[model samples]
Target: MRTLILTALLATTTALAATAQDASNTLDRGNWQDAASLGASLDSADGYTIAAKATTLGASVSPDSAKAALLKKAQSYANQAIKLNPNSASAYFELARADGRLAQYTGILESLGLAGEIKKALVKAIDLDPKFDEAYVALGLWNAELAAKGGGASFITGARGDQVIPNFEKAIAIAPTTIAHRLEYANSLLLLNRNSNRSAAIAQLQKAVSLTPVTYWDKQDLAAAQKKLDALR
Candidate 1:
């Protein structure tokens, strides 16, 4: 009787395994490309997902061989998204981001022109979608980095600090939950306050360290900011 029971249990387990394998195979056979194409045709979230995945993969991959393939794929998806919906500011912004990442990987001077073009495209994106916080964030960073001599201090000051602070503040106002936006804003404030407001700069760096996420880059940046604040102290 015991032997018969063991035999039955083994058969049942084998049957269940076979059934699970069949289900897995069936799921694997589903046509993702067709589904994605349909989503693209209908202007659905799946299309955005595809583009976002491509962009993320492009950014995550190495700069060496076969990595360029991922970037090319990202470019293709971004272009497809833009083609599918010309009115989508997010699509253009994502395309610009992908291009910027690629430019960064491939010598800044070599791609400076492309970066400038992407910057211009982002401006158009903001004009099209004024409420887009990501676009504002990108514009703020670009302006901070590309600003003329003296860290664009003269230009930003002449503009009543609105040109820099307002853009970063707007991004923070729109997306209070995003730590990146806050960190970027704080970094910009630190630069702006270097000569005029050392105490304010230290405060901003402290806030940046406090608000940043616990990722590697965030932790590193937070540490650096804290170190600077300590030096000021």
Candidate 2:
């Protein structure tokens, strides 16, 4: 009886690992729905994290009309992951991503309201994992967006324009080959102060265009970066 139970437990663990791998493979292929479904079925923190990531990617690729709904779903998944594992850096990161993306579709005041939550989530993610390079990129974008909103928003949020490049630089230092980091850094530079940073922004975009894309988001950003670089030049 003991041997049978142990065998069953081992089989269950193996099945779960295989399912998790399948979810990851689906995500890598950009089959967001399958990836999310598989992830959510696992009922684990890591699984919910994958669901959040897949849903977030779905939001990004969806039409503008569908984006907000998917982003909200992503937020829900991320929150679920956090509940299961409070120390989950990826969960916090995905929550921040979903919130920040959703902000773009919301009204001005509501968007401003979300800024604080997004920043807090990103900060928590970074605190949990100091080497989380994407969190730094997201933090940079947060500052850039607030700075773009001008004095009233910046004052309300305590967002300093000076922090944008520094955060992006930190991400780049940590993961230099990441296409999104270079592209987003260039994007933030242009968004905050295009006139003064145009040359630097162009350099970053050039770097982004030269990097190999490893995921759907990376490919999308790489293409955009190339287009932007061409237009700038």
Candidate 3:
């Protein structure tokens, strides 16, 4: 499932870039403004346009400036999309991804509201589309991190470790091809290792790195995981 999602994302990215290039070739000032104006409308017709714009900006922009802009745009569109189609779990899922990115870029504490929003939206997405692997993965990460931080009320406390691991596992089972999802699951394992499962954490990190493609960030994470393993050894 992860593989399918990655493939779809890659395909979508390619198609979008090509479409944008085609539009640029013929775009006049009037057309551009018209498109932008249409995009701002809170309707299904506009949701994809807004999401595409945010995704394109997110992919092209520097992490510092680009993400901030993307987060704001994504939030606005996501809200509108939800209002337009209350059952559109994908809209909520997209918002959750955007919020998660913001939380990662800023500290979780700083973006707690966004993270909470993601959590809420994901719950709804799961209710609407139970097979949504991405939502489950995001939820797992959110719950694990929040649990680690000692947030989410008393009954929910550290017990979330039990909850998080299963969600991640389900996500992995559903989408084995998504390296990012597995890496996130491994991260949660590493956190758990800090308490009781050091050996298992090391194993998970090793597998994560082995499965990851050759990207700068992946290499860096692999190196860090190796260092951690060495320290444990």
Candidate 4:
């Protein structure tokens, strides 16, 4: 944060999309699977799951493979994209996202080390685009997850998870209607301080469930949000 944010303030906020805000316009789903082989030709959509609904949601219903092989494949594409354009914030963002997925499968100690890399990448993405609310959501998730870990875990990564609420609120402030921001904030609340924040979490989830979907990913998230809200209720 200190390194990347300092640099970003000095640098211009480049308007670039890491993942397609609207998939139809910028994302080409046809060649999505070819990202591994395509290398530098990767677009903002390359590293993300083509079927996030199936890949993520399926894991909830059944024990899907947890190898994170697809995430690593996506990482390769992000790596190539970074090599091709050093200044591409989207590339860095994808790389960070991939690292996060890998950490989920790899375990906590290894993921703790990877947190630094993820923080740097997300910070750089924000440096490139100050209004990158998605990046903020990612940042909030990072903090929230680490905060959930607590104590030595936070010290290891220099993460102030207690202060993660501002990150979530900042994203929500920037784009009030974005269900993702609300859903993620609700998650952070429950993860960090569940007992006290249960009501708040439900409130955010309520807003999230009521919102309309604007992208394919949004539909998946909305479904998850409703299920989660049901459980909470």
Candidate 1 displacement at residue 200 in angstroms? 4.6
Model 3, 144-227: lDDT tens per residue?
A: 777677645213423366778789888878877655666677677666557576666666666665665544344544566666
In model 3, what lDDT does residue 52 have? Answer: 33
2 against 3, candidate with superior TM-score: 2
> Model 1, 1-233: lDDT tens per residue?
99999999999778655653443233234433333343334343336534443443434534466555555556666677777777778777777776666665676454555656667668878888998897887777666544422534334323234467678778878876555565566556655556665666566666766774544434545666677667877
Superior by TM-score: candidate 1 or candidate 4: 4
Clashing pairs in 1: none
RMSD of 2: 1.4
Top candidate (TM-score): 2
Residue 218, model 3: Cα distance from true site in angstroms: 9.3
Error of 3 at 152 (Å): 7.2
**Against the unseen true structure, what C-alpha lDDT does each candidate score?**
0.59, 0.93, 0.63, 0.69
User: Distance from true position, residue 190, model 2, in Å?
Assistant: 0.5
Show the lowest summed lDDT stretch of 10 residues, model 2.
215-224
Candidate 1: misplaced stretches above 4 Å? 1-50, 57-69, 148-162, 189-202, 208-233
TM-score ranking, high to low: 2, 4, 3, 1
Better of 1 and 2 by lDDT: 2
* Clash tally for model 2: 0
Give residue 101's lDDT in candidate 1 (0 to 100): 60
Model 1 — which ten-residue stretch has the worst lDDT? 23-32
Question: How accurate locally is residue 231 in candidate 3, as Cα lDDT from 0 to 100?
Answer: 73
Expressed as tens digits, the lDDT of each residue in 172-208 for candidate 2 is: 8999999989988988999988899999999998888
